[model samples]
Target: MTHEHAFSLHVPDLVFGRGALAEVGEHARALGLTRVLLVTDRTLRPLAPVTRVETALRDAGIEVILHDFVAIEPTESAIDRAGAAGQIHGIDGFISVGGGSSIDTAKGANLLVSRGGRIADFLPPPLGAGRTLGGGPLLPHIACPTTFGTAAETTGIVAFALDHGRGKTTLTGAPLRPSLGLLDPTALLTLPPMVLAANAFDLLSHAIESETARPFESRPAPADPARRPVTQGANPFASLGCREAIRLVAGALGPALDDPTDIESREQLMRAGLLAGTVFGMSGNHLPHALSYPISTLAHRWTAPDYPDDHPFLPHGLSVALAAPAVFRHLERRLPDRFAPVARALATDSVADALIALMRRAGLPNGLTAIGLSDEHHPALVEGALAQRRLIDNAPLTPTAADLAAILADARRYWS
Candidate 1:
């Protein structure tokens, strides 16, 4: 394998345990926080983890202002509200206490409120004004993840979908990543089985995509240094993390999702998530993730189990899988010998087979139709997926418009 001799990695103070939520206060206080903006979502308002975090912060004499307005795929307006809450309250520290959506909301809000800018200004070029975030350090925030997907907690990038996410804008930089990520298995207890399974699929997919990411040497380096992305490519450090993440997800995700109270399984998935987040945070994903953007943005249908009625749509992980079964099957055929490790790590006869089985058992949508898309949606969906050239460029193989359409068309039906 082609690899770099010298590369750098940014790692946060990651704390993982069966009950890591209890340390949120001490971590905040250690940062010399007197007041903090506690960011979460409405769904988690009644959960035990939120209560524990509040008590810990308040008990430590830290004043807490709750910003629970976060929703899935938060819009610029939603995040701005969170930024306002943080800046207006005169809070010195920040904490995100839920899934990728909540933590990512805190990341975005913290960026604008502390550094000062509309969300568009910090996004990558052609999508936003392309501003840099390197003047100085921003606020210190702790990420307490309640879900196992999204790896946003360990990444230097925050992805927000606006304009119905026709194109997702990103806020990227080392400072945008959290200072600490707390993994408490207890927080995951409230997640329903299907919820756990869906996110775990995300974790598994992230690792697989990372492992197959195009090598950095193949691409021309960005002329503008600031435009350099966190998803650089497959590298030594990232591969190690992705490999382990795939193994952990394959082994433990089934049990954890099947039984939410299985702390041992939950702990393993958490570890896998952390590894997946770290790997994809830097290495990035390709086809499945690239297609997921349009799937999420263009989604007009409603589903409820984890998401509320007003906020209707499939979750990110589930959406990522709509085209995944076909995408991976195509990938294996195109790059037949390139993914031996992935095939083995998943511990299945076929990479796609294992993925299909997991999704099948989890009640995850096996097709675009299942998630509320039809033949009429295909042309628009393909156009949107193609627009994400940044991600598509990272794919193991370059796909034509026809190829992409075929994948979507194949995804429109059952997993077969």
Candidate 2:
């Protein structure tokens, strides 16, 4: 494993297990939150877990104002609306109880309301105006992640939509990490098979990305140390988390999807996601996440049974997995010796074939075309990927526009 002279690790104060949702209220109270802004989405609002969170918040004497209209990805407009609500309610603390999107929405709102700026003004350069962040205390936020992946509850990154909601970029800083993370497997028992599979897909991607990320020793020190990214590189500390997460996810994904009501499988998958997220927090994700942005942004709007019609969109994990096979194969040649263990972990000589088999079992997208992209989308995909320099730079190898185009071309059909 690569070791660096200096590296920083950050994680939320974590509470895990079946009844972990019950602890969120007390956590908020302990943090001295009197007026709290609870951000969720229309889809999750009707669930029992959300109801329990609300009841607990109210019972704790915290005045909770619900912001339930957040987009599935928490678009710029949705964050604006959430921030407006927070400003109007005069909230001193924040709570997010849903998937990664909801947790990101809460972080977005906290950053906007406390710092007072347009979201673009605080984003990383080239994506935004490259405005410097303010040195001020952000409102304390408790992230209750009902979903099994994305690990937004522990990361310092928050994304916002751009280019007419056809692209995405992130705002990163240490203050953006949640003060606490509550992982409750009971909240995930009701997930449909497809959704459950998507969550596992993300966890799988996170593990591979963490294990194969650029070595921290090779990265140059940031010019501005205060605004560092959550991921550094694949260090010894991060490798342990990534390996354990991979083991847990490899064992749990199929079982959890097949038996949605199996709380034990869900708990294990949740733990895997948390472990993976913690690793990426200190040692970032690379190409899979970077390449997914445009494919997700420009894909045909498809609706899932459990999701809202207005919220119709491809899940991020599906988009990320669309190119997984191609990515693993491409990287195997680039870092043959380093990736041998990752390939072995999946019980195969070829990481690409292993990833393809796992994704097929989970029933994820077969390729870029399966997600509604086509030959016509290649240029656009490269363009979108190029704009994501933050994620792109974290890779052990940087892809030229032509390199990205080739990957997208190869991703046109995974099983072909």
Question: Which stretches of model 2 miss by more than 4 angstroms?
Answer: 1-4, 124-129, 222-229, 304-306
TM-score of every model versus the real structure: 0.94, 0.95
TM-score of 2: 0.95
Please provide, for model 1 over 276-330, each residue's C-alpha lDDT reduced to its tens digit, 9 standing for 90 to 100: 8877877778888888888877676657466676857767888887777889888
lDDT of candidate 2 over 1-416, digit per residue (tens): 33345677878799888898887778899999999998998788989888899999999899999889878866887787788889888999899988888998899889878977667667665556677656676999998888887889988888767647657777777788899998888988868888788878788888888888888888777766654556788888888878788778888888887776888888898988888888787888789889878877888566544555665687787878886678777878888987887766766788788778888888776887776778998898888888777778878788898878888888988775
Global lDDT of each candidate = 0.81, 0.82
The C-alpha local distance difference test score for the whole of candidate 2 amounts to 0.82
Model 1 regions more than 4 Å off: 1-6, 124-127, 163-167, 221-228
lDDT value, candidate 1, whole model: 0.81
